[model samples]
Target: MRDLKDIELFLLDMDGTFYLGNKLLPGSIEFVDTLRKQGKNFMFLTNNSSNDSESYAEKLRKMGLDGKIEVFTSGDATGIFLKERYGTLRIFLVGTKKLAKTFEKYGHKIVQEDPEIVVLGYDTEINYEKLAKACIYLRKNLLYVATHPDINCPSLEGPLPDAGSYIALIEKSTGRLPDYIVGKPNPLMLEMVMKKTGVSREKIAMVGDRLYTDIEFARRSGILSILVLTGETTLEDLRNSSIKPDIVVENIGELAKLLQKESGE
Candidate 1:
């Protein structure tokens, strides 16, 4: 196992890794403080696309964390990736109006009538009308893309259905799955992070609570993975899972201590 001291950049998952609902996990603040003191960098990376990056930044700021507009989200990554591949293509966004605005901000053409691509995100306000339209669009052979495939999002209230669940519904109805699922655990997200941060894969570490999404992304992308027990995967889950993280801790608190000890700080 590689040492935490070797990590130069930290990629943090939001919902389960740093905070859930309105509460920050133990040591989340200290983790960031220590990284900043050591001149290391971290970025908040989330698969949820129902909200825009600005919204997340504001949330983090309210939670007493230093956040900026550049914090990455599955929605942002998907929009940027799509724009690069198919510039200004007519896109039918199956997401919140906020997410649609993001695509529009990038100069992509948004059309409900005849779209070239149908991008799905975590639409909390999803309704029958939206689903019906998405079904018809996909049936007509428009390219399908998903922000992420997280089946559930962890909230203080409880786990709620995320974009992946909606994607499943649409796929069942249209007999077609998304052409691409862009977000955590996907190389596209890591690629975008590396590009934005100017960090190499070896210098990056993905920290989260899930093995399937967070750790899988690190494993597949040749980056380090740190699993904290503050969220979804339990120790038993790790034992049974095929994918393994390089380091496992009870929570971010212990992780910060590990870094302090390693650096002799």
Candidate 2:
């Protein structure tokens, strides 16, 4: 594993790494402050595509964290990737209207019928009729794409159905899955992060609580991974998991302390 000192960028997970809903984790702010003091850069990266970057930035502000409008989401990365690969293709979207607007903003044609691609996202407003239409479109051989494969989204209330859950249902019904999933653990997301930050894979670190989505992403992308036990995964889960993070701490507070210790501050 590479030393944390070598990291130039920190790609933080929102739900687990920063705040769990309405509350910010202990030391999250301190960690960021420490990083800023050291002239390091960081960004919040989430697999949730139900809302746009602006919404996330607002949420961060409400949580007492200073953030910008350029906060990254799986939706943003997926939209950019799709536009580069399949420009001007008509897409049927199974996401919030906001996500559809994201696609439209990228110059992709959004259509309800006879689409060339059916893109799935975390649609909080999903209905049975929308699911039926998406399945029908897939049955008709439309190419499928998923923004992320996260089965559950962590919230203050608890876990709720995310985009991956909906994708599972559609795949089970139509006996087909998305041709591409453009989220965590997929190199495309890391590529997008690197492009946006001007950081190479070797100089970035991914910090989160989930092993599969967060640690696995770092492992696959050849970046450092730090797992915090303050969220979903427990210490036992870490011991048994095949995908191991380079560093494991109780929370961001402990991580900040470690950094302070390393720098002799």
Candidate 3:
């Protein structure tokens, strides 16, 4: 409650928080508009590593939001993390062509053979050869890292297999799991967010609908967490879960009104 006044940055989860499927939630635009008008910072923080930031930016543009707004993904985090931790190294990237470009942007050479490390992302363009090579590398005991743990990605038709699903298959084949998963609920993403935004944990808030990823990420990162019952979580679910959010609202629309009142807008 009191923390909202001090928050300089709002790290938002896209799918379930800002919109459900293709439809934008109530006050989705108004909340962001209000934040911009008040000179606060916000970023679309997503775990999807299949698509690059530009793809997400385009998606947002089609959804009636400003495409030029800042967007970050688990792929961005993984690339930055690898660069900072290991400098430039040969990476066996199992992801889309867009994702390969993302790693290249971080100065890492994407190679097919003799990779120093193996990185698994949401590879929408995954093929048997890619999987076979990833499994072979994992079997060789190379450093393994995955983008996120989400097993399924939401789509207009239904839930589609995501990176985590591929992780499971690779694990089964090589009997090895990822050494590190760099995504929500890991707190690594939050550290990257802090480094990029130059915002203190005390001045940041995570707004999302999922208790496990979004709220847990905030709890682990020592930032304020706001849960909106507009996605995967329900009030009953909250009552049953040990992981709790700092604040709960009916929806983003309600939270927007509250923010307006707090700011005397």
Residue 189 deviation, candidate 3, in Å? 0.6
Once model 2 is optimally superposed onto the true structure by TM-score, how far is the C-alpha of residue 208 displaced, in angstroms? 0.4
Give the residue spans of candidate 1 off by over 4 A: 67-70
Candidate 3 per-residue lDDT over residues 1-265, each given as its tens digit? 4457788899989888898777888889988888877888899899989889988888888889973488889999999998899899899989999999989988999999999999999999999999999888888899999989888887767789998899889978989999999999899999998888889889999999888889999999989999999888899999999999999998887877878888987
Q: Give per-model TM-scores.
A: 0.96, 0.96, 0.95
Query: Which structure is stronger by lDDT: 1 or 3?
Result: 3
Pairs in steric clash, model 2 = none
Model 2, 93-124: lDDT tens digits are 88998888888877888888778989999999
Global local distance difference test of model 2: 0.88
Best to worst by lDDT, what's the order? 3, 2, 1
Total colliding residue pairs, candidate 1: 0
Candidates 1 and 2 compared by lDDT, better number: 2
- How many clashes does each candidate structure show, in the order listed? 0, 0, 0
Q: Which 10-residue span in candidate 3 carries the lowest summed lDDT? A: 1-10
